[model samples]
Target: MEQFIQDWGYIALFLYSFGGGFLALAIAGAFSYAGDLNIYITVIVAGVSNFIGSQFLFYFAKYNKSYMDETVNKHRRKVAMVKTMLKKYGSFMIFIQKYIYGVKTLVPLVMGISAYNPFKYTVLNAIASAIWAIVIGYISFTAGKLLLSFADDFKYVGFFTVLLVLGILVYSFKDKKKVKKQ
Candidate 1:
């Protein structure tokens, strides 16, 4: 695996990086088996992959408005709120939107569906994805290290940690909304 990555150079790294949230998981696994993987390089690969993948999805969403409308219609109230945030908050929301799971997944689609601005989306998406990749990668990597130190069953423990982080993010966002309404 290490030899393959070394031979493929940046291209191999890019694919692994762009392979969604699982990129970090894969990186952790690779690191355990191969001593050649560097955290900095892994983070860069993940960040670039995230930027490219999200941008691709964002454009797809833009050109396919009817699809977005159909999917988004189910969450009418949330959609309305998101639309308002996009209009008023614009770049800021685009920057942080990628960190919020469901919100992150739908944001590019939402951006595509409403006043689709490619340049703005591209810039903000790059910035946001890079930041998220670095932060999450570091956190996951650190947790993986700690887990490995504790026991041999580190992978499953790390997996649960990732799930826990995702769950907390989702729960907190929902709780925030509930509090806002009350």
Candidate 2:
């Protein structure tokens, strides 16, 4: 297991973080604390990937108007909600969306469709992704120490249990949100 992580953890982190992965980054943080990965490298990988992912969304939406129109039309309400957020927060919504559970991808698209400056959004998103990576990685790394001490040989189980509980919560929350949106 340790060998597997040492070999492919960063790769997995890159792929996951590229899509605005939250939980996977936390798992990698704990793995780093456990000596399976390097914390600095882990944070860097996640941050860069997140930046690229967000930039991709922004550009994709900006350049692909026909496709975006269809997508935006399908999720008009969600897109409108993101637009409202953008209006309320301005460019800071780049940072704000990073932490939102279900709308991480939607934000960049909304910004793309609006008059948000591409270069400014890219720069702000880069900063926000780095900040998010550091904060989340450090918190999980710190918690990993306590979880390891508490779980003893069952640290893996503890991690899985925690992930499972979070998954259930997020899944249920999304369902309720979906029904409400409908």
Tens digits of per-residue lDDT, candidate 1, 27-58, equal 55345334456667777777788788878778
- Model number with the top lDDT: 2
Candidate 1 has its poorest 10 consecutive residues by lDDT at 25-34
The predictions' CA RMSDs to the true structure, in order, are 11.6, 8.6
Look at candidate 1 and give me any clashing residue pairs: 17-45, 18-49
Q: Give TM per candidate.
A: 0.63, 0.82
- Please give the distance, in angstroms, between residue 78's alpha carbon in candidate 1 and its true position after superposition: 4.2
Q: Pick the candidate with the highest TM-score.
A: 2
Candidate 1's C-alpha runs over 4 A off are 1-36, 84-88, 151-182
Whole-model lDDT, model 1: 0.70
Write model 2 residue lDDT over 37-125, tens digit each, in one string: 99999999999999999999999989998899998999988988888887798888888888997789999888887778898998899
Looking at model 2, report the run of 10 residues with the lowest lDDT sum.
146-155
